[model samples]
Target: MDGKKVILAEPRGFCAGVRRAISMVEQALDYYGPPVYVRKEIVHNHHVIRALEGRGAIFTSSENDVPEGAVCVFSAHGVSPEVRGNARGRDLRVLDATCPLVSKVHQEAQRFARAGRTILLVGHADHEEVEGTLGEAPASTIVVESVEDARALDLPPDADVAYLTQTTLSLDETAAIIGTLRERFPALAGPATDDICYASQNRQNAVKALAARSDLVLVVGSANSSNSVRMVEVARNAGTASHLVSNVEDVDVGWLDGTTAIGVSAGASTPEFLVDQLVDRLVELGYDGLEIEETATENITFTFRPVWQTEEVVQP
Candidate 1:
């Protein structure tokens, strides 16, 4: 393993959305004291959830779990209107931390429903963001999980339809599925801009590039992170071995036994510190030389706005 080098990819971790979501929790804790109830993991990263838990953030699967009049923050994945209604019923001081990009998608869903168009939402049906978006027009929305699902649609050929995609999905795969849908539905409309988040797209592109020359590529992100898993898939599709890891502890030393070169990339929700630790561990394993593969530069930042910017505004 001696003298082996590792290539890190640019724009690998902490997209603006995740950064803004994490900051909302931390800032809520700072301004409102301990016991800030956050509904669901603020982002997909467990390490991030644990860190915030240590800082006095309480995570609950449902907003109904929060006590009356307590502070509750929605996750970055956004929430269904039913969840928001539940929060209101509980009289919790809600601080919605949903990513603005996600919010934009939600607005589009509502607009399409108003126009009486059946929606073809492209994503994993069970993801929270998908669930939330589906709630916008449950009667009018259809979940498109794969090309097979797109083909199995029972709607009429001339039906009015609009297509919206999940923020974190395999770009190539999604494109292929959309192509199938386009062939089947001539009047299909799409979002004004691409729905795949910029961070997700950049990270996946970098992983594809890294996989081209590296013997093995390690992606640092939790299993639940969609973008992270997609990055690994992209690498594998590029004809290289790839693994999804949460941190340095998850990196198996054996993968490097005979490897001369390695590639590392992270999901948007992953913290840079995790990548730093992975690099350090790789160094210890004899893959010392490091180079950052410049694929893209990200300078985006999101500013958060609470439902009500006060420590004690009880109703929302």
Candidate 2:
């Protein structure tokens, strides 16, 4: 609608993990010449991936596709032990970019397996993170993506049970799934701390706050981005009409037909540039005013430098 206001959510776009992953690729490119191979989309943001690609990083779906001795960086989603082993067998110089939170899940999985417990992983079956975590203890872990899955999961009668979740998931939905799991497995052991990372929870909370005050919500993120997709769901669940767009081109003008207030938020992996582009597009589409809703402040940062660096700056 003409002369409508656009509300933006703070703590949107680029979580610490995504920032670290991108920086890993950039640093790798700078430290080790061109063609630094990365396995999988670093963080599911096309713009971020393209920016790195332009800077001479090559992305591959499998380690086998990479030259044996070339430096390879794993995606933020993390990788299976099998993938790690395969890379090691090939003697690939590896730099893991898995988020520390996700690594926490992996460590829990290892502990549960070592304790001879059956692990229930709460996430989509095919997601790279789930696949990697599943690989952690394939024989002892089962993937459950929904409350329904939790309800119908048939586990060994006497098997000790525990659960770990994907870092980026709809908070309420995951909570419901966990509720069902606890109901069924009275003895289930969950993470000592919540597995859903702080960034995911904060972003969703921010989007819910933005969606409540706006007539419509626009989520800036790739379709495959778990956190971005969950943000859209969170907004809709808050009773606001929400659309998840990869970029300005994906924003449907028809959704603005009668909306007077629109809110914009980005996924953890999305770059600020894409958010700016989306806001600019909204202005072009007749939303002239802008307001930012600050739900929380993010002071967290992560950094990594080569072992040879004389001085490495790690921020928090």
Candidate 3:
């Protein structure tokens, strides 16, 4: 123990939803055999996707890329009706691996759209999750990426509107956008518990706490993970120097040489092994003060298979 300290943010890796989604892929492979094609990355981590690929999961960026009559699994980020339609058209045996939380947001979108409300989806327009949520009602939904987008919206002054959000966004950022949307719409409708996932909020909150007592924060996650990126933002916003690394190899000891205490956190989809690697590397570098700082306890778990999986079909 070289005397410097390491603090681990609580509720850091593999949230319930991500765990459920990955399990679906693994189970599908066991039941359906080799060559189970998965739509998109399944989760945002490249290492995760690579590991699944090694297990015989084929990842295709587009639904059309899968051959006809093949077993296809949707990624955890969810997908649009158009993608669903494409899968159906190709006669793919589709097993949806979407997190139920995301499905809930889609349900809200559909309910709002059906109730004749113009939907304001608050999220990055290009994110896969947002694209899927917006596709719930293409003609009735618009994406508001920021406060400016909310302010510049051109809907009729008296138009009925409801809003939903991408699950991986920061709670504060989404709230600010929602605040602006409400200011514009006067009577904007929305979800009761907010669409940002519980796990995302927890990791961010944990980072805030860790940042306060540490000189540097290390967020173990991937570049494409929205929640991972947001965790870095949370740490930085809390007045600590932070870096997002895919793993320990990406860690620059240079960022920690002068640091007395280090805060460590991981994205929802990040594997626990990566966090372990980071901690081990830091100890090797002489930062041996170790402490586990837990900001929350997550007991939530998902228990159900996608409806599509239950349908009677030929074994592949």
Off by over 4 Å in 3: 306-316
| Candidate 1 positional error at 67, Å | 0.8
Tens digits of per-residue lDDT, candidate 3, 1-316, equal: 2469899999899999899889988988888788999999999998899999899999998999999898888989999989988988888888888899999999999899889999999999989999899888999999989999988998876779989999999888888999888887888888887788899999999999999999999999899999999999988988999999998889876797678899999999999999999999988888887998899999999876654454323444
Residue 131 of model 2, lDDT score: 94
Q: TM-score order of candidates, best first? A: 1, 3, 2
Flag regions of model 2 displaced more than 4 Å: 1-3, 156-158, 307-316
Question: What RMSD value applies to candidate 3?
Answer: 1.9
Q: Write the per-residue lDDT of candidate 2 for residues 268-288, one digit (tens) a residue.
A: 999899889988988887889
Provide the global lDDT of candidate 2 against the true structure.
Answer: 0.89
Q: Judged by lDDT relative to the true structure, which candidate is superior, 1 or 2?
A: 1
Residue 222 accuracy (lDDT) in model 1: 96
lDDT (Cα atoms) of all candidates against the true structure:
0.91, 0.89, 0.89
Better of 1 and 3 by lDDT: 1
Q: Where is model 2 poorest over a 10-residue stretch in terms of lDDT?
A: 307-316
| Candidate 2: residue pairs that collide | none
